[model samples]
Target: MTTVVHEFDWPDRVVIGTVGRPGERTFYLQARAGKRTASIAMEKEQSAVLAEMIDRMLDELVTADDKLSIPAEAPAELLDDAPLDQPVEEEFRTGSMRLGWDPRTAQMVIEAFPVEEEIPGSDDEALDVAAETESEPSEMLVVRIPVGTARAFAERARRVVASGRPTCSDCGMPMDEGHECAPEADA
Candidate 1:
């Protein structure tokens, strides 16, 4: 099967959002360019990591290109609070995600590859590198978000992650409704 990469360059909006309540929420990364929009379901960890990498990449881009118009400060809160668009069909459940900055195009590329399952009894030694490179990914979702949009995404994603269950101040473990850390034994 040929690998089809969905690219969204110069999107009108790129945002991270969730569905359901705090504890039982499902995270989604959505991008809108013209009339087409792509939404992909992802783990909270993926969202956090993507946000972090984007922030780092944007920093590098700013240093490389002095004329870039991206602002240094991210919004204190999400600029858009709208939920995932209706008929939210997930493109794919992301397994490995990557971010790259294209100097020629001056666009940040975010790519999501489908999770590949290992067949039982498959020998790793028998798999050749060329075969691997030639094989097409079942699906890939690529979105080129601008630096400014990326910053907003990073900030909002951090907020969403921090808004999860409270953590214990001392042990840093997640605290439930009635969580009571065992008292320290006489040391």
Candidate 2:
């Protein structure tokens, strides 16, 4: 089967956004350039981790090379606070993701693969399936953005992840309208 690669090089916009209420929201990683768009569903934890990882990577790059033009924070001009584009259609559910830096272009590359369905069989059969699918993924999203835009993207992602349902101070669990905090037992 032919793999579909939704690639966006220097895209006009890319972001993590959600729909529905805080506690019942559905996270999506959307990328767009001109009239083309690709939206992929992702878990809330995935979005948070992706943002954190990007920030950490950028920080390390700054420390490693003082001469590099990496910024300490997202530039004001690059800040994106707008809601996601209309007609948010989910193309796929994200499974594994890869993030990397392209020194040649000074861009951060993000690749997201579709969730692989488990084949019910023995361990050996699973290994065989893995080997067969290793070379080709059914579909993937590949986005490449500059450092400044990457910073902006990361910042927006962090905000979106944090905009979820408030957490209970007692149990550190998400609190809804009818949530009850569980008491902790003394050690």
Candidate 3:
């Protein structure tokens, strides 16, 4: 799995030591000659077998010990995209504040987060007693929003509520009538 190579040069010869594999086989190679030595993994066997093969190969070849250096000419990367060009305005969530995109003007509209409260008394059973009905606040909110993208979000909410039951603006969770979508009764 792991291969190690060692190269040493003497005044007269060089000695190299290495161990690892030869493709599908395992072996270590050691080469020693006049003034040069290099070691590397070359086969599937003991270093002795590798040395015999390496000795035969190195004995006939021209040996050089100098290492040449090459440099890359490509320019370094620069952060050319980012610039002081825009301000931070768009946001995902803002507590009770809400906004939606308007296709007409490509802007945002402020929205009213509808809030509903239940009757405290167990007066639900008194539905038959029409006169006993309690008065409730108007669920519709008509807050004036500045002209721009922010105002568009609210206009969309108003349209959606006027259309029918309201749904979650973020995830499209349906709020059916008499439940999540219901407005406060003005009874």
Which regions of candidate 3 are displaced past 4 Å?
Answer: 1-98, 127-139, 142-187
Residues 1-187, candidate 2: write the lDDT tens digits. Answer: 7999999999999999998888889999999999999999999999999998888999998998787898889999998888888888999999999999998898899999999876676799777977686668889999999989889999999999999888888888998888987688878
TM-score of each: 0.82, 0.91, 0.19
lDDT of each: 0.78, 0.91, 0.28
Worst 10 residues of 1 by lDDT: 125-134
lDDT of 3 at 168: 60
Error of 3 at 26 (Å): 76
Model 1, 1-187: lDDT tens digits are 6887777888877777887776687888888888788888889889999988888888877888798866686755536656667767788777898899876667789988877755445567555654576587878888887666778778888888788887888678778777788756878
Model 3, position 122, has a per-residue lDDT of 64
Tens-digit lDDT string for candidate 3 (102-168): 3353322323222234445666566435334434223222122222212222222222223433456
**Which of the numbered candidates is closest to the native, going by highest TM-score?**
2
Listing every candidate in turn, what is its Cα RMSD in Å to the true structure after a full C-alpha superposition? 3.1, 2.1, 37.8
Model 1, runs deviating above 4 Å: 75-78, 120-134, 178-180, 183-186
